[model samples]
Target: MSLEQGIVFSVLGITLAMFVWNRLRFDVVAMLALLAVAVAGLVPTEELFAGFGHPAVITVAAVLVISQGLVNGGVVDNIARLLGRIGHRPTLQVLTLTSVVALCSGFINNVGALALLMPVAIWMSREAGRSPSLLLMPLAFGSLLGGTMTLIGTPPNIIIASYRESGTFGLFDFAPVGVAITLAGIAFITLAGWRLTPRREENSADSKLFSVGEYVTELRIPADSPHAGSTLHSLLTTSGDEPDVVVLALIRGEQRLAAPSTYKVLREGDVLLVEADTTSLQTFLDTTGLELAHQAIDDQEAESEGASNNDGLADESRGRNGFRETNGHNDAVGAGDDKAASDPIAKGELHLVEAVIAPESSLVGQTANRLQLRENHQINIVAVARLGHRLKRRLGDIRFNAGDILLVQGFEDSLGGALAELGCLPLAERGLRLGSPRNTALASGIFLASIAVIVTGLLSAPVALVAAAVAMVLVKLLSAAEAYKAIDWSVIVLLAAMIPVGQAMESTGGAGLIAAQMLVLGENLSVASVLVMILVGTTLLSNVVNNAAAAIVVAPIALSLAGELQIASDAVLMAVAVGASCAFMTPIGHQSNALVMEPGGYQFGDYWRLGLPLTVIVTVVAVPVIMLVWT
Candidate 1:
């Protein structure tokens, strides 16, 4: 190999190794690889940032925005709600939810589609008294399958299209193949997926997916607060906001009343136990100066890790300094430390909440700058995920999407309503049903119109989708907020950053060296065997590395392998695409999978039992299908 190629290859190789070891973040690794390429003299330093401006990158970012718009528009939430009312049979519930997921993913973002439906799946598992393991894997897997049947269904397809920018761009050219694979995959899941899952048998009853040692705490509405003059009913009506924060008891000096009336007048020192999101609860605490007799916020993070036996009070020291009464000393909050700056809800009563931001909120692509999510609402967007790809940057600049899972820390008395007003719905198991059942006819009508415009070549796919988005917005079918909330920004960043790296590798002859190695190893093996091997490699790597990164890393090698075998590069590329998106084995592998983890009360080991077999089924089924049809 030439000097430049060897250097690039070594850097890429080590980066892949780090990714596999699961230590450093993939985006950080990609950025480092980009820098190494520039230093190795393969890529021009001036041209190094060029990849960040790629079409795939912009499309991914824009798509996240569009997905957010769709979500804020309320079309997806409407459909998800319909799926929720599908009754208590575990088999029927999984089948129904998966079916809905497939339909939603086909026209829009698959990851976004799954994000809307996962909470419903959790609810079904809890209500049916079945393991969430029975449904979430399938729901997640179904979303991946659903993306196959349409042009705009998934970002990878968009990236693939950008690669073939000058192709005829027929909508159905790939649809038939996708439809066949998706149907076969879903059928396999419906018939055998649930049985493969191991149940998480928790001692707590299944009906309550989330219930802690929460006491009925009270707050005093100060004269200087926002609710000073508001009616008792208006201030206490958190039912529309948070159902878990029940208004169980209200106390005024000597008299303690159960379920205080909405008309009751509010004065100082009124105690209430109202179920609320951390945001809402925080708003309440700061706005009303509420105090808790017992604070469980310190110990809840461990609960997220599934350690329920540790009493909420036993280990205040293991938590942050804010709750370290056991140590009898509070450390100073240093201005210079990064940790201090990063803690959004550092002061006041701390509440950690994981809320699912819908794909349709106007929040997508927005830095907390436009939203001021913390300053105005008193909540922080700590971490966000676009399906399996997680954000590695600041919570402020990371951008929001519909299906993005946000790890937010705030005071419950302060920020709940603002989150809801922003069109973000809590995924923490709520009483909210899908706002309304999906108008299948309207959904079908608008979606088909969008497709027709694209297929007939009347308009570009983006333009057509936008038209449908407008109609959905105007008709009150989908709100402007839902539309913006649906886009996945992390995937956009991963795709944007890594696409150039692939080009650099190819340009540097790194692709040739990798291809030579792959082909020589496969030497006399049949093309089919080689294809399966590539698919297998991608599948194994995806479970460990971020899948988008996994795809970008292998695309060059797969195309190289194809060249060596004298076969269609597209065929091998398709294998890489399929393999990278097929994660099911671990919660860490996919967001839909992880979203269900705590709610499902699943043991981490349970995934392999179901996921391993499902994966094998996908491989066994995908190879023959890809070879027969695509070839």
Candidate 2:
């Protein structure tokens, strides 16, 4: 190999290692590789950052924005509502759910499709009396399958289309092969693939998937309590042996302060909403002399002469260890009281809901305390459930991860907006702003018109999609901020940085060297066998790194191999596209996979039970289809 080729290979090797290690984000690793190539003189300095403005990057961003617009316009919500009417037979439910999600995936961002529909799947599973595990993986996999059907469905497809020298692939260019594979894959999943999924139990109280019950309760401070006048910080830190409880909110008279300052002074008659287990609740009650709100109300009724006429706060039952029980619903404290009208909690405006962190959420790696969630968003995280693992840390001390299910408490009016800003997907269904017929019509019309433009060659894929995104904003389907926030910058950066690296591989003849070696290994093998090898190799690479990165790195080599074999370049490139989108073997493979992990309670090893066979099916089906059509 020449010096430049050696440098390119070494840089790529290290980049792949870093991607696999996953210690750093893939975007950071991609940027490092790009710089390495630039310093090695493989990529010109003037062209170093030009990938940021590439058509593929623009198309990916535009698609994400458009996906968000569809979401805001309630386009998917209408479809999600239809799933409730599907009969409860497991086979029928799986088929309907997967088919709908897959179809949606063809046009919208697959991850976005999964996020919007995941709660619906869990709801369907619960209603059908089945484990969520049975449906969630299939749903995630179906989204992946659906993405392979269209150019704008997934970032990998967009990246692959950008590799065509003639121009990007038309809107429905991938339909032939993609539709075949998606139908086959969905059929397999609905028939027998879902049976392979592990049946993990779900917390079924009040239709909630997580156990967020007595862990969060309200305690009232009595006038004689020794800790009544102490600051919250002082009370918690009084002794190292104090129970590991977090005060989520402080209620004084009609005022509710969520995530109150640690230094705020506690007053007699103040109610504290805290998160603690039974043992900690008892310990805190004993050591601090704080009484459960129900107990305190009973005591006040007993002491007053005419208390029988007052509202029956004493009627509220207490759970074990004197904690105020919410039964299954996380109803607010002081509910049903006219005196507390100023407080959202007392007015029944406060709602407790569960949300899952999205893979690209800004809240990942952040602590509730650090994000100032209660202060900034007027919301507090009462409890967290991660991959079926019980969290032992205090609520504020726990760091958030993608797929962590959080039980959040906030006013119903602002809760949805807060979760959206935080990049969380609510597990509970809520009213959609654009669920109205007019808005839905507008969003659908704009999207279809853009597809028409691309189909008729009126505009290129990126330009048409970008125009659609702008029209959506102009029509007020989604606001400017929401449109900007919808773009997954990590994927964008990874693509921008890796595009040039892929070019450098070809520019330095590194891709040629690798393709030559691949040819030698497959010299005795037929062209079909070589195609399978390329497809399978790309599939494996995608399982470890970002799918877009996998495509960018592999497309050049696939093209070179096709040239060497004197076969159609489109056929080889199509193989790479299919393989890159087939990252079903591991949760790390795709955002859709990881997004469902905790919700489904899937172990790392559980994915391959279905993913392995599905991947084999994709490889088996994709090769012949590509050969027959593209060749």
Candidate 3:
């Protein structure tokens, strides 16, 4: 290799290794690579942050906002929720969610599209008493397959479009082939790819949905408690080993205090109604000066209580006898009247959940009260987590941050639809996760119209996308605050950092070098083989690095190769775009895949079983389609 190639490859290799190790944030790692490359004189100092301003970067941000708007408006969630209830008949749910993901990814950033639905998928898997790992891989694969259809759907496509604009290709040139490949790929996934996804023989399904001991426990407050004289503080804190625990009620006298707060000081004989780990509860009680309130411990009691089928749901625990747990005794009375336990599926009832807020959420600065989240939307904000640290809950008072995780409780419907509307990302659960109902059609219309106008060449693509983003804010599909919250800065940072690297490659003829490598491989190969090789190479890169960054790095080569080979540049660029999105072999390949991993209890190797075949199928389907359409 030449000195420049060696230097560039050395940098790329180190950055990629760190990215896969995940010891450092991908954005931070990419930025470091940018700085190192510039300092080494392999990259221009002035152009280091160019990728940040690149159209692909901006479009990804805008599409995230649109996806949030769709979630806020309840357009996508409504359909996602419908699919959740159709039963755990694994095949049906997999196909349903995979199809939904594919279609959604066509318009929105696939990660954002997947994040909005991921929680719902996990919830549904649990509800149907199945291991979530079985379905998450399929959902991720569907998202990757679906991302191929449109220009803005995946980063590779956007990069391809930008390259095409440099006199390489025409608009709509790749759509026919993309559409064909997408259909055939979807079929392969639904029929065969899903079968390859292995399921662990989980004795209990709740293990996939609940953190197990993360919720079961005991809590005790000391005698002579300060709370004896104080009201539950207006501020609430939801941080604990028990993620599901929120102070629902406190008992001093027979009266119950529902939704007690940080301000509530301690008092003697006060029993705290909390969710906690059984072992941790004793230690916590000893540490806090509280004693365990004993329940009769015997086989008769256990047998009489009966076993529960709701995956350790607190509600099912109470249905055994007249005994029930409630935040406030009065609320329990209300629940008693409502009989929420009768049917766990359809009732508009209270539930506890965790969700992460997307980037730049409008709720960042506003107090939860300012949003009137509970009154206007009917969902309760139990707690908020900024970055990974749980914040002190003034709840109504805490400013929401992009990437903040939220602990919430409320009617499922309101939480599903309205949570997005309230400028929050509900942690993916597997039930029928719905979105806000207030503005579904309006948001969908504006988003689609932006594409229509762009396709008709009436407005520039950037302006059309920006208009859709702004209209979402104006129409209150998302508030100005919410619109900003929806944008992912990590992605933005990664793009900005990598753009200069791409420029450097083009400047040093690095792109030409890679293209030459591919051309050599395809010397006697047909057009289809050339396209497949390019697509496969891009796919492999995406599997190890950020999908967007992969696209930025490889795009110049797709263009360079097209020119050198005397082929239709658009067709070659489209091939690059498809490969960039097909990173199904690893969880680190896409944010959507990462987002689902912990929640679904998925192992790293589990994906390849399903994803490898899917990649092959896409290759088989796409190569010929490109030959037929682009040639």
TM-scores of all predicted structures:
0.67, 0.92, 0.76
For residue 390, give model 2's deviation from the true position in Å. Answer: 2.1
Q: Give a tens-digit lDDT track for model 3, residues 1-631.
A: 5888777877877887887787667889989989878888986656676677777678777877887787778787776667746777877877788888888888777776787677767667766777666777778777777777777777667666776645422335556766777777677777777777766555565532223223432233545644455543411222222222344445554444434445566566665655444443444444444444323222345677874322222333343221233331112211222343332322444556676554335565566667766446655565565533455434455766545566665554566666666545555442443445557778778987987898788887777788899898888777887777677777788878877877777777778988888788877887777888788988999899887788877788888888888888767877888888888888778866766665455667877887788788888888887777776
Q: CA lDDT of each candidate? A: 0.61, 0.83, 0.66
- Residue 240 in model 2: lDDT: 62
Worst 10 residues of 1 by lDDT: 325-334
Top lDDT prediction, candidate number: 2
Best by TM-score: 2
Per-residue lDDT, model 1, residue 593, is 61
User: Candidate 3's C-alpha lDDT?
Assistant: 0.66
Error of 2 at 295 (Å): 3.4
- Please give the lDDT score at residue 422 for candidate 1: 65
Candidate that beats the other on lDDT, 2 or 3, i.e. the better one = 2
- Per residue, candidate 2 scores C-alpha lDDT tens digits across 1-631 of 9999999999999999999898788899999999899888899899999999999999999999999999888999889888889877889988998999899999999998988888888777877777888889999999999999999988888999988866667788899889999999998998899999998865552345545554666788888887787888778766664356867678888687666777789999898877777777777777777777766445566688545423322233433222223423354555335454333453346667778898778888888768877658878777788878767777767888888988887776788889988889887444434468898999999999999999899888889999999999999998898888999899889999999999999998999999999889887888789889999999999999889989999999998888888878888888999999989999999999998898888988999999999999998898999889988
Range of the 10 consecutive residues with the lowest summed lDDT in candidate 3: 328-337
**Deviation (Å) of 152 in candidate 2:** 0.6
